[model samples]
Target: MSKRIFVGYATKTGSTKETAEAIAKTLSGRGFGVDVKPFAQAGDLGAYDGFVLGAPVNGMAWHPDASAFVRANASTLAAKPTAYFLLSLAYGVGRASMKRAIPARLAPSSALAKPVATACFGGVIATEPPIVLRLLFGIKKGSPRDSRNWDDIHAFAEGLAAKLAPR
Candidate 1:
């Protein structure tokens, strides 16, 4: 039987969901049985052989659902091959800046279960921010943009598949 993997994600603007699906698709092509689902919809973790969890950084932290899922499933995660991916506006800030920013954002999850691999991907900004957020962040409607690197995402997924492959 093929190894079973689950890719769970939480997203506000949809970039993270796309990321999870891309990883699932890649892993499926590599011969794993992959399932992609929202964090809220994820059921028991024990049935999966490995996991790929992803979420967007809303402020300095991950979306609450993603963090909660990690905390709730830490035991199972620690016993298996687990990877994490984060979508953040910081990734758009340049490589050095992103390198400096990643640890802080990952701290919470790392404390729960040490991921076998981790990746940070650039985020897509809402074309029109809510009035309050726009005023707070000084972003004009349609000003910010999507900075996701598809190649980087694919490479990360490929690497994850390799790591999970049986020897």
Candidate 2:
């Protein structure tokens, strides 16, 4: 039977969704049957053999929907070969910048199921928000940058695929 992989993500302005799609594509290229869905639309995690849960980091916290999905399906996830990835500005610059943005608290835990691997990738910042939203939040014009490292993402997906390969 083909391994079933589900990539569920919560995105505000589409960055996280893009990352999830990319991951699904990579896994599909590696021969796994992959499903990429928005966290709100994802249903029945128990059907998949493996899962990749991801979200964009906002205000130093993960999106509530993404976190809730994992929490709600914690048991089913714990039983499978699961993995997690994050998208943030951290992965863009040097280690110091990455470190400051990606915190240990954000990493997947055994409580959420011992994922085969976890990753933090860089993300984008858009400039189309309303002025009030930007000013109230003290948001500045962040440079358009994609800190996503495709090589690392591919390697991680491949590694997970190998681990979940049929015995």
Candidate 3:
């Protein structure tokens, strides 16, 4: 059977989706079949050989749907090789904020799954949106910052692929 790699992401305005797509593309280029899906739509993990979970930080924690997915699938996840990525504003901040904000934890199941290689990427902060939508959602835009380190992300993906490849 073809090796299957599943990428599950939680995105607010698409940054997380982009990051997941990048990883999926890289893995697919290496010959693995990749299935990319939002966390809510992702179903059983039993069919995949490996997994990549990506999420954005909001109010200092993972998005609820991502967390819920982890909680719901922890057992199945624990049986496979998995990795995680976090997108947040802490990327450009000084050492203190970076230390506190980055390296957010994955759900327990993911942690228990094969050792999880993780990446912390800087995310986009939308400056303006429709006022009505922002008001209804209580959205507050953060300052624009390029916090993503493409080199780091690429390295992490490469390393994870290497680790998950057939022995």
Candidate 4:
């Protein structure tokens, strides 16, 4: 039987969900049985052979639900081949500090259970966010942008097939 992979995502503005779908599609094409769902609805973890957790960076940290998922499923995740992927706007604007900061942010999940793989991808942000979101992100005004690199995202999924190869 093909390896069954579960992809659970936590999305704020929905970009992470899309990324999860892309990863699931690529992994499915690679012959693994993949299921993608939001963290709130992600079903039984014990049913899958491997897992991929996707989340967007928010306020310099992995989304809270992502962190909570790891915490909730800590033991189950430890026994499986688990991977992680992050979508963040932390790239391209040339913030060198993010290199160190992002990993620090990821600790909440990574510390709970070691992962077989990890990937960080560029993210998307709306130009005119709601006033609260704008204030939270320190956004004044600008054109919306999507810096997601599909090639890299697909390549990450391809690499995951190897990392999650059936035992």
Candidate 5:
């Protein structure tokens, strides 16, 4: 039987969900049974063999919903082959310091489950900044830009599949 994997994500906008979908598609293509869902609807994790958890980076930290999920499921996650991915403008549109903060920001999640892999992807900004951006960065308006690198995203998923492949 193919291994079952859960791809659960939280998004302030929708970039993280989109990234999670892409990850799920790649994992499915590589012969795994993948289920994609939002963090709030992550039911019965024990039914899955592995996990791919993702969330957006906001206010220089992992989204609270994803962090809370990690905290709540740390025990189950630590016992499974798990990976994490984050989406953020820091990926391609921010200063080096912001980019440098990604690992530190991800430390909380990794400290819990010690994932097999972790990735950070560039995020998409809509024509109007989302509330999170306005509240966090005080950006009231902006041009839309999609900075996601499909090659990097696909590669991250492929590499994660390799790491989590059964013996």
Candidate 6:
């Protein structure tokens, strides 16, 4: 039987959900049974052989639900082959910037259990963000756009498939 994998995410403006879907699609293409869902709807971790959790950076941290999920399931995650991905504008700037910033952003999740694989990808700016965010990020209206790299996202998923393949 094919191994079953779950891809769960917490998205503020849907970017993380899209990333999780892409990861699930790639894993499915690799012959694994995969299911992608928002973190709240992911049900139980006990049903899957492996897992992937994704979240976008908000104030240099993961969405609360994603961190909560990791904390709640730390033991199960540590026992399985698990991966993590983050969506952040820092990635568009450069890897060095991302590397320097990731530890604090990932502290909540990593504190629970270390992921077998990790990836960082650029984020999207919604066409219309709340006024507070616009001022905070210096994003002008109409400048909202995506910077995610599909090729990199797919490559990360492929690597994850290889990692989760039966030994």
Model 3 ranges off by over 4 Å: 107-114, 128-144
Model 6 scores a TM of 0.84
Arranged by lDDT, best first: 5, 4, 1, 6, 2, 3
Candidate 6 lDDT by residue in tens digits, 1-167: 99999899998888888889988998999999998998889887788999899998887787788888899999998788888889886554334645467547876687688888888887887555566765555545665378798999999999998787543
In model 1, what lDDT does residue 33 have?
Answer: 97
On TM-score, the stronger of 2 and 4 is: 4
The RMSD of every model to the true structure, in order and in angstroms, is: 3.2, 3.9, 5.1, 3.0, 3.2, 3.1
lDDT of 4: 0.82
Which 10 successive residues of model 3 have the least lDDT summed?
Answer: 134-143
Residue-level lDDT tens digits of model 3 in 1-167: 66898999999889889888888888888888999999878777777898888888776577777777767777676667777778876443324544454564544434545445776776666654355533433334442445577787778777888766543
Full-model lDDT, candidate 1:
0.81
Q: For residue 78, what is the lDDT in candidate 5?
A: 87
lDDT of each structure?
Answer: 0.81, 0.72, 0.71, 0.82, 0.84, 0.81
Better of 2 and 4 by lDDT: 4
Q: Using lDDT as the measure, which candidate wins?
A: 5
Which ten contiguous residues of candidate 4 have the minimum total lDDT?
91-100
Model 5 weakest 10-residue run by lDDT: 135-144
Clashing residue pairs in all predictions, respectively, total: 0, 0, 0, 0, 0, 0
Candidate 6 structure lDDT: 0.81
Best by TM-score: 5
- Give me the runs in candidate 6 sitting further than 4 Å from their true place: 94-99, 128-144
Which of the two candidates, 3 or 6, achieves a greater TM-score against the reference?
A: 6
Clashing pairs in 6: none
Write candidate 1's Cα lDDT for 89-139 as tens digits: 656533454446655787888789888899888778765556665554444
What tens-digit string does per-residue lDDT give for candidate 4 at 60-125? 888899989999999888788899988877542224565446656677688898899898887887
- Clashes in model 2: which pairs? none
Deviation of model 4 at 94, angstroms = 4.9
Better of 1 and 2 by lDDT: 1
